[model samples]
Target: MEKPQRGIQSIEVGGRLLTTLAEVGEPMTLKDLAQQSDMPAAKAHPYLVSFGKLGLVEQDAASSRYELGPLALQLGLACLRRLNPVRLGTHAATALAEELHQTVALAVWGNAGPTIVHIEESSHPIHINMRTGTVMSLFKTATGRVFAAYLPDKVIEHYIDTASHHSFAYPKSDLRPSWKAMQKTLKEIRAHGMAQVVSEPLPGINALSAPVFDHEGHLALVITVLGPTALFDPALDGDNAGALRACCAELSHRLGYAPE
Candidate 1:
């Protein structure tokens, strides 16, 4: 047996793979796994087995499918408790989602881009997202835009340049807007510390997003509440904006971003 690829084989790479799995909750095909893991199928196979053995992931019996197993869930929940943004954002998103009966997400910059760290689902079947692990761009999405806005122009430019319009397998063009337009949008987000986008990224998806600053006093994460376009308002209803701001303030505080 070729010596099991030993020692830290780029913790960052493993981190990215975990992030990918978190973003895509359902079991993925080997091809999908390779693409999402950014590794050759052959390479991923061994590690997938390793992870399965450790109970970090489970290989489904029916279709030999893979989804995060119970152990992984245990670890994830443990990590969530320690993660500042998750702690703050999860409660906030959950409350808002339950109150308005809309989907809410607390997102943050992961290895590749913006990733949904926590999600609160709506009550109705007409709700937006049913599952977690959805990844979207930091350029075109409301949460992404809030994330991009806080970064430098060069950082924002990179996201615009590298962003994929449709995140899945099928590569699509014309879905992405011009970089110039994205830059202008980022400018506005920077000024306001938040952004609202309607029916743009995915049709009928309306959302409001804002950045959460950390102890370093830099934007560290984003939180967004999403609903059908029919419920969107030109402005967030009474106290909603204040609630979001308060959440950001608390999260940032926990992260060591105390104001001077």
Candidate 2:
């Protein structure tokens, strides 16, 4: 492995104070900030003074508490502005496909519905009708269900109304016959942080999907992985499901999502 590059020790230590403030999400006194950073108040004061001059942090005159300054807000906004969920999710899905040896796809809420934007096929790709731009069923496919679970009721209801006029291959069974029943299903999906389908959308195929949220806690995209049922484990507690959730969680974190 290549040797790691050296860095300044003082700057790293000072950064800890800023990180603590961000995590605490509140103004903190110098002593409290020092304690949280595991440094002495005297040692941390100089860094705080330097940070205030740099506009990375500011102190309230009355409360005498330190918090992130305008510069910090600017930095955060800049980062959020550059984030492209689809681009980032596509890269993550590609790596996930390689790790799990299953086909992975990225879906976003399109004008029509949950539309697949990218697909990363496994070494032994499964033969399926799905491709980029294929809009999935809101109530049937795992991908669409994930969006339904997180999206507003109005959006889902609108799609359901449109589907009524057109044949979307909705199963005749009591999949979501009533609004109450649909809410219950959505509740379960939200609780589990994912949705799964076994041999329904396509016979002999199993799939699982999880949502990626932005910093605002809004659904940014959904990542779905599918494979032949015989080869894929669809259990919620299974290894495949665990890996899929982990992938989504990491992506969500990158998007600045902090789960409550």
Please report how far candidate 1 places residue 202 from its true position, in Å: 2.8
Number of clashes found in candidate 1: 4
RMSD in Å for all candidates:
18.6, 2.2
Against the true structure, candidate 2 reaches a TM-score of 0.92
Tens digits of per-residue lDDT for model 1, 125-208: 344543556666555678877876786667656655565443541233432556666777777776666688879677877778
- Clash count list over all predictions: 4, 0
Q: Candidate 1: which stretches are off by over 4 Å?
A: 1-83, 125-130, 160-176, 234-239
Candidate 2: pairs in clash = none
TM-scores, one per candidate: 0.57, 0.92
Residues 209-256, model 2: lDDT tens digits: 999999999999999999998899999999889999999999998898
The per-residue C-alpha lDDT of model 2 at residue 88 equals: 94
